[model samples]
Target: MSVISAIFVVLITILMPPAGVFAISGCSVDFFVNICLTLLGYLPGHIHAFYLEYVYYDRKEQNRLGRFAARPAPGVYSDRIQSGGQGYGTIVEDPLVQSEEGRAGATGQ
Candidate 1:
């Protein structure tokens, strides 16, 4: 999602928390939870929706951009990777894929 879309979602959240969460997360567990929260109280729904969004709006885009330049930590490892072109990005790995590859290499050896 883009910044403009994010802003729109935020505005929607302010007016109707559940609707905004539905827009962001779709009809998932979060949506059901938001519905319950909204039923219990308005504030809780708002809190949950905002927490869910948090500009985490574009994971795949950031991951795609992460392939390019980034300044790693000077020593050991930095939890974060900073890029001049964008803000920051972190690579998400699939453990299943890693394990499969590892097993294949070991069996071949």
Candidate 2:
């Protein structure tokens, strides 16, 4: 995330805890739950916001590392070549023959 976004998230979490959690989670259930917690008390809302932040960062890091690990290395060719194999040959079928056969079958001949 950008520095601006990080600062915005921190500010929102501290000032408006429930909204921060909702923005991070983007889940209706989490949003409503955080709102309820905030209504009950500020501490609960802050705690939940921190938890959401931790989860978000954890998942983000995991995705970044996963993508890095999954990429092929430089100068690597991944395709495999078939050895001593005859390349593909076209098998042709006449459309006129197929149509005539269809007509004969339709006429019960």
Candidate 3:
């Protein structure tokens, strides 16, 4: 999250504790619960808010990394061009592949 958003959340929590907690949790829980928690103790509400933020950010980061890891590496193809073959076909030449091909051609391989 940006610093502005962090500051905004902190300010909201300090000014209107219950609303801040509710917003931080994406309103997944009852507003009354937040109100009760805030009423019980300001620190408890802040703690819950921080916990929710931690979980939210952690999950977001995990999802991003998961997506990145799920993608095929550059110059690698998902489908084989020839059926029943274990080798991958070169639809587009990677820089390494291009250089290797050039060397092979020069060597008459």
Candidate 4:
């Protein structure tokens, strides 16, 4: 459950950065829903609906989405969140508290 939702969230985060924060915030919901679907794989949950809702909100509120999305420039939070460059991690470290800017500047650009 957690594992599957984590996978989905990670995928979404990679494709669309905003989803990462949303997924981190809504980890519990995703985990539970994924668990339910896993237990009932034959009649699994409507993931399309979920994706639609997520996408709609993400696009509709681009400003807020920007705030939620990963920064094009690297930051302390990104460094902590990234797991060996693979983007694996269930826990979302506090974005506000991160202070180091890493060896590379911004996106290494």
lDDT of each: 0.64, 0.59, 0.52, 0.42
Consecutive 10-residue window with the lowest summed lDDT within model 3? 76-85
Clashes of 1: 0
For residues 21-83, what per-residue lDDT tens digits would candidate 3 score against the true structure? 555454444345556677899887666555544444444445455422333223212121011
Candidate 2 ranges with C-alpha deviation above 4 Å: 67-109
TM-scores of the candidates in the order shown: 0.56, 0.55, 0.46, 0.26
| Residue clash pairs of candidate 3 | none
Q: Name the runs in model 4 displaced over 4 angstroms.
A: 1-23, 42-53, 56-61, 64-109
Cα lDDT, model 1, residue 22: 75
Candidate number with greatest TM-score? 1
Worst 10 residues of 2 by lDDT: 78-87
Which ranking of candidates, highest TM-score first? 1, 2, 3, 4
Q: Model 3 segments beyond 4 Å from truth?
A: 1-3, 67-109
- What are the per-residue Cα lDDT tens digits for candidate 4 across 19-81? 454454344344444445545652233352244335434433453334444543232123212
Tens-place lDDT per residue, model 2, 39-109, is 99999878876766655554445545542223422321211101101122744466799999999999999
- How much is the lDDT of residue 54 in candidate 1? 53
Alpha-carbon deviation at 26 in model 4, angstroms? 4.6
Which scores higher on lDDT, 2 or 3? 2
Clashes of each: 0, 0, 0, 1
> Which residue window of length 10 is worst by lDDT in model 1?
76-85
